[model samples]
Target: MSSKINAALGREIRDSLREMRIQLSTLNHRVGSRLGLKDADLDCLDLINRAGPISPGALARRAGLHPATVTGILDRLERGGWVARERDPADRRAVVVRPVQERAADVLHLYAGMNRGIARICADYDEAELRVVADFLRRTAEAGRQATEEL
Candidate 1:
């Protein structure tokens, strides 16, 4: 009975995750379409913007993507003049990927708009109501960390 209960709970969790992803994805698609960038491309741009100049492999690790996938994304951004790869001066052997002039404002604005949109949405709710959602997500993420630690 306990095993069955656990199995049922697992399925419920899976369904909930799927629903959350679908809704979140729909929102991102709407935003990304307005901005004209691919989902994968956004992750790549964000890594450079957030992590400073990092090698392709390091960027992939930071973004939780494979190197080949990151390479393809960079290719698009490079061709669009949105990103540039430069040789690491200290490590002369390594090439670091970074956003060049063309993409800087666009890349930064993407995150800024999302934050502003979220803030605007949160404004509709009372502070107490917003706090519950924030606390729940934090706890859920912490629980995920604990689960991963056990493995």
Candidate 2:
């Protein structure tokens, strides 16, 4: 591509990414409000749910949260019935967090509209296009992670 075209595309991509970030942040806040939880609490719940019974220390590392902060987040989640803490069988002294599946349906329902929108948008893409989009998203997410680490 010509330099002019490349620059224009870069500007457009950056603009879109900024807009997406703002929208996602708003959506997350709305979901958190619906569940009566803070964003950090919801983030911890999501991390625990995806990781499947992870140790608190591990969650803190993954989430870039202080262990003390994680403790408070877990306390709130536990109280809200969004997560449960259990003794790790392999290491009796260690505790692992698990998602409270029964409560997950309500949270999932809150995301249904967005999920449907994403599905509709994805339906317009063929396999090749989806692969490209997936690759772009994965790389973009990694870049975001790296940027956060710098801060």
Candidate 3:
């Protein structure tokens, strides 16, 4: 009986996660449109911003995109003034991509509403409960990364 209850709870959690993913994807799409970026372009930009300065090859690997595709996205982003390509200090011959801080600020501004909403929701949870929620989200994200690698 306990095993059955656990399985049911697991399924419920998975379903909820799927719904959240869909909503987030939709939000990203809207944000990308506002920024005059394609979904792929915005996704690559987000990765670059989070990873800090990264080589094009490394960005391609992290984004799971072909090198040529990454090159095109970088070209578009560069032209849009969203990112800058500069020489990697460690390897003078290599190039690294970095987000234009001013542009990143614009992106963050668009997300302000969502961030506030999440903060309000988090306020309802105590530290212990929030810690459990954070742990679950972190593990779930890791599982997703593993699954993507497997694919």
Maximum-TM-score candidate: 3
Query: TM-scores for all candidates?
Result: 0.61, 0.96, 0.97
Error of 1 at 82 (Å): 1.9
Model 2, residue 144: distance off in Å is 1.2
TM-score of 1: 0.61
lDDT tens digits, residues 33-114, model 1?
Answer: 7667787776677678778678999888766787899899899878878788999988988899877866677655755866
Question: After best superposition, candidate 2 residue 82: deviation in angstroms?
Answer: 0.9
- Provide the global lDDT of candidate 3 against the true structure: 0.95
Ranking by lDDT: 3, 2, 1
Name model 1 segments beyond 4 Å from true.
Answer: 1-20, 107-113, 121-151
lDDT of 2: 0.93
lDDT assessment of candidate 1: 0.79
Residue-wise C-alpha lDDT for candidate 3, range 2-88, written one tens digit per residue: 999999999999999999999999999999999999999999999999997999999999999999999999999999999999999
| Model 2 per-residue lDDT tens digits across residues 1-151 | 8999999999999999999999988999999998899999888888998996999999999899999999999999998888889999999999999999999898899999999999999999999999999999999999988999999
